[model samples]
Target: MNKTINDPNSPHSIAAEFGVLGSMLIEEEIAGEVIQLLNKSCFLVPANQVIFEVMTHLYDNNKPLDVIVLQEELRSRGLLDQIGGSEYLFSLVEGVPSAGNVEHYAHVVRDKSILRQLMAAADEIGTLTRSGNMDTEELLDRAEQLIYEVTQKKAVNEPEHIYNLLLNIFADIENSNHSPGLSSGFPDLDNLLSGLKGSTLNILAARPSMGKTSFALNIADNVGVRQSEGVLIFSIEMSKDQLARNMVCARARISPHKLSYGVDEKEYKILTTDASVFAQAPIFIDDTPAISIREIQAKARRFKTKNDIKLIIIDYLQLIEGPKEKKENRQQEISFISRKLKEVARELDIPIIALSQLNRSVDARDDHRPRMSDLRESGALEQDADSILFLYRDEYYNKETTEPGISEVIVAKNRTGPTGSVKLRFIKEYMKFMGISYQKPT
Candidate 1:
């Protein structure tokens, strides 16, 4: 039904609707582009709506478009005379300045249409509230979901040719070394897995005090500082300050105890000067403990849009909570949480590194090495992770071991490449990981 102009609050623009139709008539190529953005109900003028409906029909059925074709079609459907004959259609093509702005004009019409829908939604919600029948929470959820649908409507993608796909693949292959996807800060690791491919869930697992959190923080700092990329760190176990102190220890090569407990003048000077590196780095920390997956997903999405965040690091997976309503089993809940994290990675098109804990079975073994089965909630984490890295430090088990400071990142599961171990030096005092080849000053 056409909205009467007497109602002042009805959201509609007659000029924008006419502009979109006129531009489409003037240029045939842009017809599809503008048509995809709007529909029949987007117009305030009923005649404009009828003209657009007929124009879309002509374009859809392979008919060559012109004023004559449109008039004949409207005449055949008995709408030409009702729409004020060919005179109104002639005026439709007169005022459009450029066909290039058709899509923009269409967007204006669509936005007005959305505003009208919001008005109707508000009325419905008011009616529901007056009746007092629906649950308050359910009503709020439905209202939010309705508004979200309006924002999500967008132009759909057409099929891409194979040549385009080949170009992207070749480009990625050529740029795999240093500037590929978000850098791992390790040349060897970047070469191994192409610097943490986008839309992947990377699991860094180990027993307690194995430096998984430190390793993730180090990677975050590397990407944030070196690449100047936005990084969001969700620290469930450690506070934001603890994370920053640990980061300082790793980046500055200072002792964690001194940075944490107290700092002397010389050490304080070093910490303050070195800490400036992080001041400019685009790193955001959220230290909410036992947060649910839903909340994390919401925050990650908002951050991705606001900051254009390139990487997300959850300190450890075990500390996260599932939905408010408890599930039947703890393992199932853990599986749900990990899967949700994977969705966040894919939706934002970024790499998400989630820390995990290993079962004590690895400690019972004489070798004291962890594997895929040692994942605390075994089945789901292994299944959902695109890559699994098990951290093992020989010094943690045997003090007089052959390689005292070397930590092994056992690539147990890699969807993109070969599975093996990458050696890095883990400094216990600083809570830092360095390349195995890095030498200390004796």
Candidate 2:
């Protein structure tokens, strides 16, 4: 058993006492006290391995972790000596029997309750640090650390891990697959975008009645029904029932005008049957109007956690509010919202399809085709978005023009690929946007 130093005046005795300094000294003596502590905790790795891992991670990330922080991290790991007072720790440092042998060490420190408590505290700190506002560089370092840790633990044969090495090649294949081969729902648009990637922000902009909502809904429905991925649509301007009605009409090939006016008995039956089919589709809608960015993020996270939502659609970015502030201008607020949405996309690792309204400047032009500058009130939308798509219908501007069936998806800004326009078929009554020439007028 380690000797308890009862003397108050003896520095050696005080050092030997099992108080804070003793625990801290013991931690320091171990060389990798933090790594040891973390290793012994739920991480379930060897001390040397943990040290090597964390050190390598920090080195790779170019982060310099201070000793005090490392000590705090160890204390968080429940590795500090809580058993015999400073005397016990002093004995360990002094090469006494209690500290010399692992069996003796275990026998001397019988109560591990402090260890559990320390572990819990450490876990709380880790969680807080991960979620709290840290500098971007610090956050990125931590993220890299986490990725390293997770990847290290992953099985060698894991498909995703193996594929990650060849990510660029896989991306190329994915892009190739997205070409306008056939009408799998807006093939031309897919050819331009290479399909919306996971963890990307795809902004769709258009004037009112130019099929912005319709086009977004069509894509969402296609993804949900064909790909069988969960999709969440937040319709800020329309009601859930109205959105559902539009989807049903589009899927059933019934005109929205006819559905809204009156349906014959046969048509009513067809609509009801089609609606039943759509009920099984993995598409969810929330028609909450004037939602804040925070609210959208919270809801998107909830949907992802609960239902594994793979895609999120926010109708009209202009309506999204920023943090409560009395003095911020509209442009600033919109900028904040746009950046937040992009952050949300990256954090959630899912595609966010946000519909936006173009400025009247486009309408004033003779061409009337929307441009990147037309993303109303927020230039950050152009900066933050991975892709920006403009929806322009020729018939909306030219009443006498014969090209009423064509819609152009202008890729005004693409962060990862070429920017160009792709044509699609816009069926207004059906509320559908399909790949160009996929459907013929009856």
Candidate 3:
């Protein structure tokens, strides 16, 4: 448990700092652990911070860490006399004879550092609020982000032993259903991609009229309704009501056009039944148009904490607003957005499916199928995504083609698995995609 301290200035413990420095000098092996646990800013005492900085420099260069070497390095940098010379170094070693309690001492210093950071962050928020220059909601979001970053700074940097990791893996295998990731609700697609793995950024790209939005909604409904897992959808291109209507029509197998005339008793029952299921499903939708990446990050973090969302789907990457910092070109802006989206997926520890638009170059191609090169605006989308799926319908290009009412999901790139295409039946009237052999029930 962390204790809240009101006084940031008085949070320093001189003895703890000395103990950490002393342990590092006593045992060279302890230096590495100390370096990983705490950095210079963790030491409130100026001399201790200087000493630890020099010690890190020596450790990085594979030099010996002791009084003699440290003194020489400090002297060369003209910080020796300022930090109280050789006596201070000797005193630190004499104060702590053993390195056994070094880790404990390090924790105390780290806790103090966190309290100070929190206090400083509070001060910053107070100043910003007083200035009254920014919008209220934006200021509040920034304030929360500042505090979040400060708290996240305490994450441990220790490396785990391979043996421990293997033990965990073995246990997972024994208790597992052989499905390491969430199912996409399509068996063949699941077999091809091994389901949607967590901590991954998946790119779903296609030209207009390829049913990209419908395909994604199908997966979202499958995961959220069928599997009873939380799903979050950021629909940048469509309204929440619009997405809901499409999903209801797809799941109930009713043509959306028929809704204009009115449905028969059976059709109305199916529609109401499916709508009820959706109402109870743990699916969250945010249709904030022209939303920037920062806003998405903020909202995604909030939803993950509150809902424990297992899947996140962003409707069309091209529609998402880029970073606040102005880029040299549109490609650079897109590259930055792609990298940040990948980071968001890793940070949230969930799979993110970002819909994307393909370049017109695909239309010029004889096959009318999208390649990785056809990703619009930037190649970073290809580089950052763990997997890329292209939606291609033969009937869209040629009405009399033999594969009418069928669509090919081209697995253009799979980072951890084999690449292949999966054919699905596209019910154009209802805006739904199902397995190739699926038949609508009477």
Off by over 4 Å in 3: 1-142, 146-157, 440-442
TM per model? 0.75, 0.65, 0.71
lDDT of 2 by residue, 75-119 (tens): 555643333233433343454323223332322222232333334
Q: Taking the tens digit of each residue's C-alpha lDDT, what string does model 3 give over 75-114?
A: 9999998889889988988889799999999999998888
Order by TM-score, highest first? 1, 3, 2
Better of 1 and 3 by TM-score: 1
> What are the lDDT figures for the candidates, one per model?
0.82, 0.64, 0.87
Per-model RMSD to reference: 5.9, 12.2, 7.4
Clash count in backbone of candidate 1: 0
Error of 1 at 227 (Å): 1.9
lDDT of 1: 0.82
- The number of clashing residue pairs in model 3 is 0
Give candidate 3's TM-score. 0.71
